[model samples]
Target: MRDERSRRAAPHRQAAFDGPGAQAGRGGLSSLTRRIVVFNLVALNLLVLGVLYLGGGRDSPLTQYRERMGVEAALIGNVLEVDPAPLSPGAVAQRLEAITLSPGLELLVLAPDGAVLGRRSGDAGAQAEASRTYVLDALGGFWRVFSGVFLGDGPLPEGQDPLGQARAMMGGLQPGAPLSRIAEGATGRFVTTLMAIAPQDRVLGAVALISPLAPLDAMARARQERALRIFALATLVSTLMSLLLASTIARPLTALATAAEVGGKRDPQRPAPARVRIPDMTARSDEIGRLSGALRGMVAALYERIESNEQFAADVAHEIKNPLASLRSAVGTLRMAKRDDHRATLLEVIEHDVRRLDRLVSDISNASRLDSELVREEEEAFDLLALLRSLTGYLGGQAEKQGIDFMTDLPEGEITLRGLEPRLAQVFVNLITNAMSFCQAGDAIRVWVRRRGARVLVVVEDTGPGIPEEALQKIFARFYSHRPASEFGTHSGLGLAISKQIVEAHGGVIWAENMRATGTDPTEGPLGARFVVGLPV
Candidate 1:
């Protein structure tokens, strides 16, 4: 049943089904707009996310802590430099214990060999100043957080003091170099400031101040969590906006596709069905709207071409069958007719039918090839007046042989036009040839050209019998020739049709009308047939 239905409405089925698969592969016209929106939203969201996640705007609490430590270290150094009584590491440690700092800071006195002689925060006179293990014990909450198991009960890794690494990079806090550096690691964050305790221009020891980062890191983590929440919210909002954008673009596109599908749909139940109405999206001042309008127009043109091809095929079969029947009859009669005169007559008829068939076939071949030939040919700019003159000069000789005067009245200034020159020339040559066919010895043919604003008009008029009112409109149709019976086989009817095709391909217009003399007498004689071709200049 499906196959039967398809066979009945093949034209519509073929037309409507065109390009749908390709359209699907391209993900619909709206996909372009949707992808664009999604891409831009994703890009902007990533940029916002990076800024929020990476930018830590908090002031370093350790920076201020280092300032305080520097001041205390300076005091200790001054005491050692000019106290008039030399101060030892024990005296410096005692002085550092008196100079109180923030809760997470500690002061240490180290000898030149990295031996901690004294520390102010813990047991000062005991084992606190001997090694960096004391600093590791001070890692506290910041240490577990950096170790990636914030609340773990397991023992912390040994030899993981970030401050020790900083000291190593600084060559053990020796004298003669400014002693300030910040160290950060999975263990913790800290800042160290060291000053040489020089007496009598000789370095005796170094006083060190260390600030822990547990407080600052806690504040930073809190800020980051809040920033992450804001970023997530912004991303959610952007995603919603992108969906809205997709809908706005996709709605119109869906309408267009549906309209196209409907127009092309085949229904064997309904014969001679009209094309489905396409939505008019041209009112929108956007490229998508323009695309909708163009697609609608292209589909309409395709339907027209389909109908024209069907009619042309029917005409061709009908036209060819007539000559074929005549040839068959002539050959059959010639075999039976034994007399020389009758056989000669039959042979003449056969020859005439053969020539008629040849002409029709040749014209049809040219008509079929016209479209592809026009596409392959390149357009060029040539002076319109010069082309017309050249055409007249060549075809004028042919017209003179028939004793018809060929005249041209062109504008003085050359008119330049851009188009396939040879194709356009073929149009004029066909027109002139057609006019000559309908004229006699005394009848005059005139080819004149003039500019009309943005358009150039070329008129080919003949002083022969004017075309009948009924036939003027139909003359340009394929196989539509009005000639005497004597001239029937001599001229193919495709001349005017081919001419029209060429002119239209150049974005020009061609029309025919009977020329009426404009004079005092109202019933003056009709002058001739006027075929005007108008092209953009």
Candidate 2:
């Protein structure tokens, strides 16, 4: 019972494994769709990054905080410049208090060494102490935490204190340069500026404007959170849309694939299914619609061609039967003749008729079987140069017997190609035999093999009266012949037709051209023609 269950489940498991690989085999369209979707998503991400990099600072809340500090620095710098007097502690405090305003500002004057020189605020002493102390103390704590989060945690190295660093950076500024600028510090970001208080730009002291780091930090965190939320939302929407789109697109393609596989396996008598109807795409002029149209056209053409070939095969078989019967009767009559002389004459006539009948039957049979037999089989790698060498050796004696010179321009390297060897050999034989028959005394034939791009080209040139220009295109049609009755003594007119069928079967092309004799190349005499066959590698 366990074995039976496993056996039953095996097909289903195999089917599951085979499903994706089968879809992958549907050619370029499947790969093209996936590439398009991935490219779209990458482009969207890059657009977002570009927006952040260029415009992020202009919209940040930190810009407001920096402007407020700049106003205070300007006021302090003006007072020190105009008075030019040494200020006592009380006088300095009074001077700071006079300029203080509501929504309030705190002032601190620091000596160049960073010690506090004077401090003043608008409110009562205790209240002022509470606000001032809170703001001032929060500065270092904020720096510690900010440094930990953003700039990284550590004690200041010797000569590397954050405030001193700010002053040193500001010292490089030219007179009349902007007094305040934004800088990111160990704790957080700050708006720092310097003022020339002593005469002739002598450095007596500096006023530092401090703000708490929370408001700007909070705004930035919020903005980032909002951007992340938006991104998540967009991704969720895109995924849902992708699922819907993939299903919509993949379902029709899956149906088409199933139909094609079924058609391939079906017996000729079995009727095809009703045409598949894909929704939402029929009315639109898009790639999918064009694809659907092309498939329908292909199925119709295939059915017609199959029907025509079957009917033609039946007709050919029926037509050849009568000629074969006559030839058999002639042979029987010759066998019964009594005298040698009588028998000899009768046998010669019978043999001549038999040969004619045999040629006719062979041509008819080849014409009927051409299409079906020419269908592509397995493709394998083979050396064209080696194949040509073998063919030349086989046909060389025949050409010599006919009093024709046989020559070859074959290279030695292995020109690797993918094709059915037997079919290719058949095409080569037909072309060479046809050339040999027309090649006259002192005439020569040359066979050349070379590689061009991803295709291998073979050319057979013969010194014979070239085919007329008008006959070139029609030479490959069934039963086509350029030979008049004078030349029809041994010709069946089916060789070129069979050669063409074989060439087209391998997805290659063949054509003929008149070769002009130039200078001393005797092989390319005035009457010579060249037949070239090109096959993909």
Tell me the TM-score of each prediction against the true structure: 0.70, 0.47
The total number of steric clashes, by the backbone 3 Å criterion, in model 1 comes to: 1
RMSD (Å) per prediction: 8.7, 15.0
Instruction: Supply candidate 2's per-residue lDDT for 307.
Output: 47
Off by over 4 Å in 2: 1-38, 57-60, 100-105, 112-117, 120-196, 244-284, 299-303, 329-359, 362-537
- What do the candidate models score in CA lDDT, each in turn? 0.73, 0.65
lDDT string for model 2 (134-207, tens) is: 33345568988898999886755332344554466455544333355555565555455555445456655666
Residue 392 lDDT in candidate 2: 93
Screening candidate 1 with a backbone cut-off below 3 angstroms (N, C-alpha, C), the clashing residue pairs are: 16-264
How much is 249 displaced in model 1, in angstroms? 7.5
Segments of candidate 1 deviating more than 4 angstroms: 1-84, 88-100, 108-155, 159-171, 174-191, 199-201, 234-303, 325-350, 411-416, 519-524
What does candidate 1's lDDT look like per residue over 1-537, in tens digits?
Answer: 323533554655332323332133234436656686779677977897668545623434445556666776677666545554544567656666655555655666665566666776533232222222322344444686766675556765443463464345445544544477776656576767888866655666676777666655556555555665666677777778776776556666766776666666778888865565556666778977797678867776777676667667777887899899999999999989989999999999999999999989998999989988998988888988898889899999989988999888987978889998888888988999889989999999999887889998999999998888779778998778899877867766899999999988988899998887666463555688999999988
